[model samples]
Target chain A: MTAVVTGDLPVIEAPRSRRSGGGNGTNFEMYAWIFMRMSGLLLVFLVLGHLFIMLLLDGGVQRINFGFVAGRWASPFWRTWDLAQLWLAQLHGTNGLRVIINDYAERDGTRFWLKMLLYTSSFLVLLLGTLVIFTFDPDITG
Target chain B: MQAPAGTLYRGREGMWSWVAHRVTGVLIFFFLFAHVLDTALVRVSPDSYNRIMDTYKTPLVNLMEVGLVGAVLFHALNGLRVMAIDFWEKGTRYQKQMTWAVLTVFVAVMVPATYRMVAHTFAELFGSTT
Candidate 1:
């Protein structure tokens, strides 16, 4: 560990540095790290709250039929809760993955393609999850 | 630690974490696809759907669910590690430390969830309250 002195304070520079010379401008990664901690904390609540409500409330797991889901989604509260959960979890997870891809993929082409694949799949899942929540029909008359 | 030609593989903590995340993500995607398809069976016929869900009561499905939850927990925790490495210049040095931290969190969160899942499956299978 090499320590760089900044005004009588010891600052350690991380090894395997990605700090390229010039024009790399801005601490976007720092902002992202902060975002993860914040989002992860929030996800702790949102995800747990969701699981509790869906799997534990009322008559517990037995009550989670199609009708129950439909009834809950009919309310704006559940819808918003679900929408927020969907967006936050997906964004947080995707951003986390993006950082992973950037850190590992050394080749320009490899990094680019891997990220492309990641983003594409994230978008598709988000779209499908949202669609299912919104367009779900409780009544299927037979 | 020699990497093959044109592999672009880095022998580092971050690299392994990335590989794991990608692998788990793909696995989760496949599980999600199968889950959605199975649930769609409900639209076909409720009786058949209940019969299908009966299969999930087996120990095999319970074990798979443990693996699925493990995957989700690992990917989420490792994703946080990657974020830390990217964001904090100081964090990159502690990559090995953070990798361990991620594993600790994964086990902590997943162990309980896996237990509950298995217990529920067992209760369903044998029809015993105790």
Candidate 2:
């Protein structure tokens, strides 16, 4: 890449450095990229499976009453499926956001505060989602 | 123009992926809010809830459903991409290739899934005979 030097007289060649680490290396960033592809593949299956069961099977959307949810959750199979989906989706999504925060937030204080906020919100959502799934009371009459 | 100090660009793949992640996250959050409110309507009255759900039975709602599913799939898959970037040392070299690969996988999985969702909704709302 070329850049304009001071005085605006001529274009100057940008310094090219082929060195790997400016003391930080590129290992972490590289690993994050690979994770995106791999997790992406898994998410495709988990998410699609979820949509199919929830939206298409049985009587479709019309049949998805409280009783239906209760029935499904009562089974270990459905519980495990839900648990896996919840954990995978949350971890994947949160980690993705973490990368964005690290890349964009320039100031240390900004980065720290933004990450703290992200972590807090992510934790809250994950906890609430898990709680609702497990402690869902089907019988509202009591 | 005088060149600014430090890195000019952090490359395209990372920036684009970051943008996509934020967009999808916002979409998912909006959908979750609507979903929770709609479901909570059931607490008011079953008849009211059914009426609310009947609104979702429409074609427009079905279209939104496609978008919703797409958002979830894209976010999840791209998230995996972000994770891979964080973990692998060689990931930087393959960032662009992996991004394309993620898009390919997303299309492969999403197109069929969307087709089925639309077809099922059509069948439910208009009947299969139509």
Taken over the whole model, the C-alpha lDDT of each candidate is 0.68, 0.70
* Tens digit per residue, CA lDDT, model 1, B23-129: 88667656654664565554555555566665765678658756766776786677667667767898777988998899888778777666666666678688989
List residue ranges in candidate 1 displaced over 4 A. Answer: A1-27, A55-63, A140-142, B1-58, B68-115, B127-130
True-vs-predicted CA distance for residue B102, candidate 1, Å: 9.5
Q: What is the C-alpha lDDT profile of model 1 across A1-142, one tens digit per residue?
A: 3333334434446876665585468888778778777776676567656655643355344444555555787898987887787777777767866876787899999999999998898788787777766765656543
- What are the per-residue Cα lDDT tens digits for candidate 2 across A15-133? 66555546485477667666656656776787778777887675456566656666787887887877777666666666767777787899999999988987787677667666666
Q: What is the RMSD of candidate 1?
A: 8.0
- Give each model a TM-score: 0.59, 0.61
User: What is the clash count of model 1?
Assistant: 0
Q: For candidate 2, lDDT tens digit of each residue in B21-121? A: 79887677546545645655544555555677777767788788888888887777776676666678976767777888889998997787677667866
Candidate 1 positional error at A4, Å = 19
TM-score, A chain, model 2? 0.69
- Report the lDDT of model 1 for residue A59: 37
Question: Which CAPRI level is candidate 2?
Answer: incorrect
